[model samples]
Target: MLATVIHAARDIRVEEVPDPELSGSGADAIVRVVAACVCGSDLWPYRGVTPTDAPHRIGHEFVGVVESVGADVEHVKTGDFVIAPFYVCDGTCVNCRNGVSTSCVQGSWWGGSDRSGGFADGGQGERVRVPLADGTLAVVPGPVGDDEIPGLLTLSDVMGTGHHAAVSAGVGPGDSVAVVGDGAVGLCAIIAAKRLGATTIIAMSRHADRQALAREFGATHIVEERGDEGVAAVQDLTGGIGADRVLECVGTKESMDQALRSARPGGMVGFVGVPNGGPELPVRQMFNRNVGVNGGVAPVRGYIDELMDDVRSGAIRPGRVFDLELPLSQAAEAYAGMDERRATKVLLRP
Candidate 1:
């Protein structure tokens, strides 16, 4: 099988590799790769920001058909089309039961050493093994049209993460919301805010394409400014009171600061961006304004079902974020396009 292998920083290649073997019997399954996507979070390892040994698999968000299932796997069966959550968690765990599968006590990060990811050696290939299949994989309701696959794939990660950000911020009827970052996840955050009944959705972006998509996703306002100016722009649009809720989709300190500053006093800030270097909190500013900050890596597993229905019904078109598509063999080009900010999200077909 051919897979995308990141041998070193700025070095990625499509290479023939041995397929993964399935030996686990406790809630495990093997899936035939249908489609996979390059993620902004994956860029951390691609750019050497995260230390990784050469030749590691690189993808996490994917949709596939089940090729096989372990004896204990009951939620899914062979031939089932499913979306794999980026995090593997047992739905029965204490944290999972509390609706926090992202922090499942027995869960592991998707594509980590303990559990192989779906990038190169995983979903980027013809087939991949998924551990904790019963909990990690969400079965699609029925056969999805090719046109719907992109949106269905979003249920695996980005769209779910974006929805998590909006939910965490408590976006409600007539609320004013601000979304920082214009990546796929950020654009979806705008959609999520709209779905939550936000009256004014503000997207902070400089890219014309992404800005356009933001509007399509329900952003009522677009702030092209950066840093403090961007925060002020959001405030001005909200009668100088700032947004009622803010979603931070960029992990950088600058983006985090903007999210914090863009929220009104007593407002909430929800962040889903993977913090590469830990960001500092403006404790004094937050205290002065009585602001509340919450959010972490999204618990996508918890929201997949509802999101899947929305996608299938055409209520949300988060899949439009995939402005570029390529074969698995061109994984490097996908990375380059994202790194250069030329594409919001890239989709790959095996």
Candidate 2:
């Protein structure tokens, strides 16, 4: 099998690697990847912003067919199409039951060590050994056509993360919302807000292409400014009251500030960015305005079931965020396209 390995900053390669096999707790499963993608978060490591002390397998979002399952795996069978969440967790843990599976006591990340001491291959590969298979892989009940595969793949991460941002902010019917960022997650946030019944959706973006997609995904207004001006733009769109809910999809300090300031006095801000250089909360300002903040690593596993139906129904096409698609062998080029801002997101087919 061939997989992506990041040797260093700006270094990405797809090379032959060992094939994954069933392992761990008699519960692991091997998934033959059909589609995978490059996330904006992956760029941190690719750009060397996040230190990569050693070369490792490096993707997190994928959709595939089950190749085999361990003896203990019960919910899915061989040949089933599945969406694998970025994190692996046992379903019976306290946190898993409470819908925060990311914090499960037995939780492990993709591309890292599995519970059995064998490698858990990253999504950017021909096959992956999915830990906690029953809890981590969501089965698509019926046949999945090639046309719908891209959309289904988004359920593994971006779509779920966007939905988390909306849910954290308490978006509801007739509320006004502002999304801070124009990356894949932010655009998906627009779709999520719309689905949650927000009457006004403001998308803050400086890129023309992303702004267009934001509108297509249900953003009612586009603000091309940044910093204070961006906040003012959002406020102006919402009749000077600011948005009722703000979704911060970028983890930079400036984007966070813009999101916090774009909310109304009593509005809430939901943030799901990976916290690259985000700042500590402005305690005084939040207190003075009665604003609230919530969000973190999205519990994508929990939301997968909730969002899968929408993806199947064509109610939301979050996969549109993937502007480019490449073969797995061209993983390095795919990374470069995203790094250079030439692609919003890239889907790779094995």
Clashing pairs in 2: none
lDDT score of residue 118 within candidate 1 = 35
lDDT of 2 by residue, 1-350 (tens): 99999999999999999988777568889999999999999999999899999999999999999999999999979999999988888878999999899898888988998666767899999999998899889999989999898889999899999999999999999999999989999999999999999999999888999989999999988888888888788888989978999999989888888888999999999999988865788999999999999999999999988998998889999989989999999999999999999999999999
Per-residue lDDT of model 1, residues 1-350, tens digit only: 77777888778888887776665555678888899988898788789998777577667888989988878889899999999888778788899999999887767754444443332135555677777788788998677788989998998899999999999999899999999999999999999999999999999999888888999999999999977788789989999989999999988998988889899999999999888698789899999998898988899999998788888889999999999999988999999999988888999998
In Å, residue 119's CA in model 1 sits off its true spot by 13
Candidate 2: misplaced stretches above 4 Å? Answer: none
Q: Model 2: which ten-residue window has the lowest total lDDT?
A: 112-121
Local distance difference test values of all predictions, in order: 0.86, 0.92
TM-score on alpha carbons, each prediction = 0.96, 0.98
